[model samples]
Target: MLKSDKLERLELYKDRNTQVFLNKFLSEEISELEPVYDPKVGYHYPIVEAIVGSVQDAEAFLNRLYNAGILERRLYDKIIYCPKCGSANVSVRYCCAYCKSFDIQRSALIEHVKCGYMDVEENYKKGNKLVCPKCHEELKKPDVDYRRAGTWCTCKDCKKSFDIPVVAHFCRDCHTAFTFEDAVIKDVYAYTLREDAKEEAARGWVIIAPIRDFLLENGFEVESPAFLKGKSGANHMFDIVAYEGK
Candidate 1:
């Protein structure tokens, strides 16, 4: 599509929260471009617009869009040619993307097979040439050109690419099993930690009775075993160790 058409479609994003995000991008309040959320999931469309803005709006927007598969990315306006087909008709590309060059001479670069960085680096710095498995092009060893700064390895064989990357966020507590986004929701409930013991909770955290009482009043089935006796200066004995529904 034409650039005018693309910008116009962005204008039609239904959620006002999204509009605010986009407006911020236009105004430079945000450097990385990201979709606020998907209207289908994060919230119902035509959000009347927050009269008094809340952080929940932003949080919900990101969580919902992340669940909805709306991509978050850094946006740029610059010339981009496909490193794959060598076509200049590229519609989308990431910052510092290493594209496979179709040229026979540029194939000397080793593009990491996975993320596709072709800008080449120390991973294979010992070598000066690569055989493009795709186009069968061999490129000369890249010499540092300060103007050409991107983290990508050019693969001579596939003429493919890989990214020079960094791990964005990691929780030492959560371990590698979960993503940075996964812990975002649990963070919302963090204040529950301040409550004293003798409460039921999730993920091994302490939960209190008043919060449980509210849930019960709201029609939640808050069950506890009647037999466990509370001992002074000991962990609150849970009537039920963990939930296993009837």
Candidate 2:
């Protein structure tokens, strides 16, 4: 078996910097942590991903941590994903609605106010002479007989013209095409320590380690994580308990 291979059961340790960060939040919650941007991954990772090493299932782990009152979530950036496969690998493309071809070109259109003839700018150009295509009138000045109307695109493949192209998304990974309505939008979140969890860490294990060592140095017996029954018939774990002069 590979040493790195995950098993069904294994011992895990907390109270590392990752957990201590939760404990240290008693002072104030950390915020404004910059994201880690990876060009290859094509996504900006949450700051906690940069801090934690063993974050394989990032979404699940962060959600579980949030449920455990260890971390709180703050609204972060948002991103769009492929609705079909939920992949972030997507691109926006403008294509002709009739033929759905990307081979389209846009050009200006000129309208002759005198004859009420509207055509492309190229049709009105006759060897540097702006001649009206309808009445064959030679144009002299702007707004006199001709005026620039609008612009449109024509599909070179199908020869179909349109005023507006349809918006679309192409999934580079799955090779599937979809419209904007089929796209999935997801919001990412930043994390901070919860107020209640921070308050518990004040008299919790955050300072218990040093206190335990101090008691042992003074010729006293100290039991860390001391378990005792309360009057309510419930067991409670205390951070430290010391006894002396036995």
Candidate 3:
């Protein structure tokens, strides 16, 4: 059961924006509000953005509702961003382990079973045919004369060979290069309306109907679920708006 005083204090369903936002869930338009990752804006809720007009506003509104127990949030993802400018527009780079140069080439390593010779595939190339560098034997087919053992990499700048390369990140927004240690990690969340709140919202008008009856019996013209413009130029909704001889 939901407390009427708490709902009134938080201005929950009475607000027009709150009603519209929750109606999407009541009508089954969306099951959950998932956070979409945008390079320029980081994690955002597109569905909420369409209603609230901006990512920042959507974030604030959703978090407020979540804190008030109207919505539930779950961790969706953990994304890495640029610590310098705090942007999620980051790309990965593979560099040579020895010299940290991006100029590198990868090749498959071939092994000749007969002579037990293993080397890069380039060394086995001979006039459109595979010839073992150690035994000088013409390789016919795979698993018979030779087989692919693994892969190897060579750095063109430092002339160094290695099995793995170093991983690094570059920010597209700020043009900054950094490793995982220097990057910022943020947790993204997805939101959904709470089941109890959904039930309460369905019968919200019933709970506030006594106020409407009281105003009508007092000889005042009343409007239930009325919208009025505020001083800030924002429209607000009320459960009952009573007018005196208007």
Q: Candidates' TM-scores?
A: 0.18, 0.51, 0.67
Off by over 4 Å in 1: 1-12, 33-52, 68-246
Give stretches of model 3 more than 4 Å off: 1-11, 113-115, 125-131, 136-150, 204-246
The alpha-carbon deviation from the true structure for residue 156 of candidate 2, after best TM-score superposition, in angstroms, is 6.0
lDDT of 2 by residue, 116-215 (tens): 9998887888998999888999977888778888887788889998888888888777878988788887767777765555555554554666787788
Task: Please list all clashing residue pairs in model 3, or write none if there are none.
Answer: none
| Candidate 3 worst ten-residue window by lDDT | 1-10
lDDT tens per residue, model 3, 1-246: 345345452466666677788889989998898888777888888888788888889888887788777888899998889989988898888889998887889889999999999999999999899999998999998999999988899999999999988988899989999987897888788889989888767666436656766778888887766679999999887656889955
Question: Quick one: how many clashes does candidate 2 have?
Answer: 0
Arranged by TM-score, best first:
3, 2, 1
lDDT of 1 by residue, 1-246 (tens): 233232223222334554454444344454443223331222222221342255455456544433333323232222222232323232221221233233222213345443344443343444665443444444344342112244444445455555442112222322222222332221111011111111111212123334455656666665443234456644443433333334
Of candidate 2, the 10-residue stretch with the lowest lDDT total is: 4-13
The local lDDT score (0 to 100) that residue 157 gets in candidate 1 is 46
